[model samples]
Target: MKNLKLLKWILILAALGLFAILAARAYLAHRAAPLGPWHTHVPNELTAAELARSDWTGYLEVESAIFTELEMAVTRQLDPADRVPANRYFDGSPLYPGRFAQDWNRSFVLDPDGPPVGAVVLLHGLTDSPYSLRNIARRYREHGYVAVAIRLPGHGTVPGGLTVVDWEDWTAATQLAVREARRRAGPGTPLHLVGYSQGGALAMKYALDAIDDPDLPQAERIVLISPMIGITAFARFAGLLGLPAIFPAFANAAWIGVLPEFNPFKYNSFPVNAARQSSLLSRLLQRRLARAAQDGRLDALPPILTFQSIVDFTVSTRAIVDSLYARLPANGSELVLFDLNRSVKFGPLLHFGGDLDPARLLPAAPRAYRTTLVTNAEADRREVVARVIPAGETTERIDRLGLQYPSTVFSLSHVALPFPSNDPLYGLEPDEAEDFGIRLGALSLRGERGALIVGADMLIRMSSNPFFPYLLDRIEEGIDSSASGRSGIDRDRL
Candidate 1:
């Protein structure tokens, strides 16, 4: 009778705790501004099976229809309050992507001067459009590779679409993109896959599928930029937080963040379902990767080239090293980690985690994959060097890169790896050649606390990478090697 009473009390306490959480969520939801049509509208996106059957042209047609619906339902129906100058959803606003000469927000294809040497399918991150990878796609074309950058469904449209989309839909869209790439570049040609953030998870999942499904084309090489291999505890239960959204009174519960939509290509507002979908995708990828390793299927895995930062606010850096890289075979994969700016210029102002040390972040030397750490040569100076550790070797080959950490930047960000310094929108010193309405990377606003629309943490985050030239050179080298039918990185070269 005493044990029964104890169990009853435990159950009662748990119920009360859950009720308190629900009450808090409901209160926050009510406190937020009313949801716009962009938050509530849902497009008629194609199903996964439908996407698999559809070719590139058919897929684009569906995308066009979805955008048409978006314009008709949301843009045309925006209230006067939402017609602010900063609103990208407002068709008349300067921030509108449609106002641009060529909207990079949509899917794009770049062709070389003549017959392409190979093909590369580029995938952008969650809540991001094809614009994020446009610069790299152009470079691939210049390198004689057909670059097919697809705009994943639920993205390149409105944030509301994300509320209903699933991870399978994104993968199905990837299949369509690869099919288009293969068709354009010809069969038996070197096929490279590049992914950023959530797209990175998709790329890995696609490659693993290719190993099992003979119908799918295998990637000659895989490149990831700040991949989302793992997520935080919040994302794991993001779906539960949206439970209140089932009631019309608490519709705002679907969104974790609702910011002013100023970015032309990317969504400022983030939905709870978006986080939920990413968590599901990353979880699935982890399971598949482990299964591949256990079944000896990792031997057939292609060489992977990844670029990641030492400090990332969005994704797990440890997961990249342990879950993904550690399980690789001796297939000549490479990880280029941008170490924290250890320059003494910042003094004690810099307060990063202690685990950022290469010794803690990466496994011991003689790793199956090559590890390259780009950091300051001396603790007191800003001059940077590449410390390269070859696969299956304990020795590190040091190479001077002639690059230094920008005085204003202490570390690279999750969104900084794929972008160069000269990028018109995200560049710290954006070029004058193009104008995307807002120069997000160059914005340096200082004022009283809570004066800004966004958080202070966002303003301080580094947007563009100064070390982008080196990243491009490395990618170009990979392109050249793949063109020559040499799949892996040159162990001797830095």
Candidate 2:
């Protein structure tokens, strides 16, 4: 009897352990789950006296509330079927010439005025707010720039509000922030724009639009981190699934994406209106590209620094590549496409095509611009030749090499490029892989004539996290070589 009781207790304990493990896994997957194309960063607000009086716990509490509020707004917005609209957190009304505006603006900065060397205007991703860019803004402030993270209209509220605001409104908001940055920076001080994900594309769009704006202040440079100027396969899939408009507001299908480890909240995949708005904006961007070519605006585009990762699952490489070739001015733009090996993998599988097992899909072998051109006459009597080029160097190289090669590069699945943090191949530790972000940032900042560094973190995140010793070694070697007069091959490739 005693032995039986002991055995029963053991069984109970084992069951409890299994349950705990399952719970932990669920939480991790939920937190790390990608909200497709969602992305973020911040500063020390305490004065010398306050710093002495307050503990880190107090600061964490305050930050926690801020994050909580931001998440609540985003979450509520994502649940499109919700009965009511989410309240707006930001007031973007033009500051009237009144005492109220002055009073509000005075207390806005979390600190006493610090002498700014310049001004930095930050743009957050779509469906996100200034909250996402807060971390990076704080960094800029630490570096002596007056960092301003603007809340785009219709954002930080209900997702439905977003549908009302068009891409032009987004462009105008960026322009407004740039103007404010310029005005605040005073004479001769440079203005820098940093855009994350969708914000990056908007920043690029603004640069193109303001290329000749006489009233605008001189934009010193631009930084694009994981910019989303093109559409992803999931986005196409969403369209193929017959536009979210056909589904109920609360209907949220499962989506697999790259989730930043820093994000603390779960994401909602519904919000059909948000998807529709995204689709519209994407079409508008295509129209803009066509118009830019027709109007000859591409040649006048401003200098830009762009960063992207090969494994980023949200924004595909095709968008970045297309933007680089079509929008960037010939001589002043820099593009960095970080590579991701297939061996690196993230778990929590999501399969498309309804019940199609993923394992059976078999990871396609890495192909280097294999091309196939087919010519056919349609029933409508239109003759067309379509060329499919898979993602590879030859297609990319051909762009710089000029349009002598095929126009289309085989599309990389959107989520495939920015592989999530949960990817099995990613290794975060204290070793040679230690400081890729700092290295990339330094290299980008230290370039000839001080070129802009677009979301250099995107590349660093995808490359360094997986602990690619060879890449890390090359980075260090490049830094050392550049210090001298010797040119580094890896640096050129990067």
Candidate 3:
């Protein structure tokens, strides 16, 4: 009798809990903002067949049509108050005053002055345009390599496109980019794939796919910046957040974040579907990586160079080591970690736990890959140095660098890896020569909380890398090695 009563109560509580959750979701959905022109203008999901039929030009044509529709809808539906002042969405607003126009959001190819000795495909992060990789692409071009930066579908336009696109669409776009790179480089030339954040996962996936499929072009080297090897598990259930969207009354539930679209190159708003698709992609990549590792096929993967911050809010830094690097063979793979700035005066306020140590994550001795940590030489000093531990060695070697961590910065962020210190938009010391309407990184905002359109946290996060020179030097070293027919880094050069 007692057991039966307990079981009955348990069932009743579970039912009540579920009912309460549904009620809360419905209430929140009803309070959401009304669907705007951007929401109504969702682009058709790109099919694999359609992507197959289209070349880069055809792809751009489809993209232009979508952008045209978005523009028309914005003009007809959006009120002036809904948009930023002097925005392209406004009537009689001058376009491309200083920064790039909306059309610059499309894919771009940069050719070297002479015949390309090598080629590189640069992939930007989710919600980011090809412009994110423009500086890096130019660098590769100057080094006598053809650089192609592809604008992934559902990006570089209105945020609504991300609401309807699937993860497969992104993978398909990656395939197209790789194909174009191979075609331009021709046979026997070194082909490199460089990915940032979400693009990092795509690059890894493509490399794995190439290993399994003989028809696909193999990458000579892979470079990743703040790679999304793993994301939060909450992303798996992100679709549930948009459950209210099923009802027309709660259409705004589809968006996780709806903010003023001030930044021209990146989307300020984010949809629930974007989170779901990224989660799905990361999960798929992990599964594929594990399968390859188990099957011994990952041994065929090319040399990998990854730059990641020790403290990243977006992706798992631990996963990068445990999931990806740990499984790799004794190939010439290198993991560069940007450590926190111990020079900050807030030592007493800061928590110094074992979790802050990078040594804990790496293996004991005779490691399969090289690990380089860029950190402050001392807790009290701003001077920085590179502490390197070569593959298959337990000893450490320190090399003093001319660079020092910025006084204001306590740590490098995931988004800060690829951008330089003097970027007009996101740099610590913004370039005054070029203006993007606003210098986001240079803003030292101070006011009451919630006074600004964007959150204080968003503005506070470091957006540009201070150590980009070191990053560039490392990439140039890799290029030199490829040109010299060497597979591994020359330790003596360091």
Candidate 4:
């Protein structure tokens, strides 16, 4: 009778614990910012079948319809005072002034002056519009390559669009972009795929898909910037956090972060479902990569060039090394790692001792792929050097670069790898000639907390690369070598 009484007490405690957790979640939901029109009114999710049937024109039509609906929803929901300056949906706002009149958020195609000799399809990252890759696309255009930068579905419209879309929809959109690129370049032209962040995963997956399907257009070369090969394990269970969203009382539980829409090109507000979708995509890609490696199908993959930071807060650098690069079949793949700034002033504070050295991640000798490290020449100087290790070789060649690490900057972030040093929005030294209303990178905000719309973390994150010139030079070198009937860096050198 005593044991039975103890069991009853345990059951009571367990029920109370569950109740307390639910009550806390409900309270937090109630305290959250009220759902805006973009959050409450979900957009149509694109399916693979629909994307396959639609051409670029049909795709644009569907996008226009969604944007129109979003505009109407915003009109009905927000007051005139709340709508004008802060909301991007409204015209004549400082965030999106009527300088262009037409929306610059959509996908764009840039053609060369002459007939295209090569074709390049550029895919932007998650929560980013095609504007992110405009610089690279222009470079490709100047080189006589037809560049197609597609604004992935669920993006460039509203943040709510991402809440409904899945990774399959993203891959389907990639297919459409490739088809358009193929048509523009015609046959016998070198086709390349360039992807940033999440788009990098799509590009890698598409390459894998091409290996299985003979009809798909094969990419001759692949470029990835801060690829999302793996993300945090928390993202795997992010969907569970949104379970309360099923009840209208706790609808705010669906959002991971709700912030003001300040950036014209990217979404500041992030939803829990978006994180879940990205995690699903990364998991699927990892599985496919592993299966392909085991079946020897990865041997058919084209040359891949990747640029990544030694320390990335979003994705795992170790995963990129162990999962992708380690499995590659020496098909002229190269990984360029930007090491942390080990300046003399910050040397003591920096963790230099431990296993933080990225070079240690590689095998003892004769690595299958080439590795390049952009790092400081010594412990005391700000000058940077390029340490290149040729494929299947142990010897390292150190070359001094004219470039010097900026004293103000300590390290590059994942988002910094793509944009140049002179970008109007994110550059450290923003171009004054071009104005994006707000020069985010140049802001030296010094005020009490809560005064800003966005958190301090958003401003603290590094957004532009100082060594972007070297990155562009390396890319152009590869392009020039390819045009001369050679594959990437001379195999003889390797």
Q: Identify the leading candidate in terms of lDDT.
A: 1
How many Å off is the CA of 35 in candidate 4? 1.7
Clashing pairs in 3: none
Mark the regions of model 3 whose C-alpha exceeds 4 Å error after superposition: 1-19, 86-88, 91-104, 486-494
TM agreement with the true structure for every prediction = 0.96, 0.46, 0.92, 0.92
Model 2 C-alpha lDDT per residue in residues 293-345, reported as the tens digit of each score: 67776665544555554445666556555545444434334454432222112
Count of backbone collisions within predicted model 2: 18
Ranked candidates, highest lDDT first = 1, 4, 3, 2
- Please report, as a residue range, the 10-residue window in candidate 1 with the lowest summed lDDT: 485-494
3 or 4: which has the higher TM-score? 3
Could you tell me the lDDT of residue 306 within candidate 4? Answer: 92
lDDT of 3 at 247: 84
| Residue pairs with clashing backbones, model 4 | none
**Compared with the true structure, what per-residue lDDT tens digits does model 4 show for residues 1-494?**
99999999999998898667666766788788787776666767468789977777777788778767766676456766657666665666667623444455787889999999888999999888887788888888889999988889888878888888888899999999988898898877778899999999999999999888877888888899899999989899788777777889898888888887878788888988999999999999999999999998898888899999987888888789888998999888899999989879677777653235875755565888899999999989999999999899989999888998888788999898888888988898999887767777777778999997778989878889999988888777666655655353222211
Question: Which candidate leads in TM-score?
Answer: 1
Q: Lowest summed-lDDT stretch of 10 residues in model 2?
A: 401-410
Q: What's the lDDT of the predicted structure labeled candidate 2?
A: 0.42
RMSD of each: 3.1, 20.7, 3.8, 4.1
In model 4, how many backbone clashes occur? 0
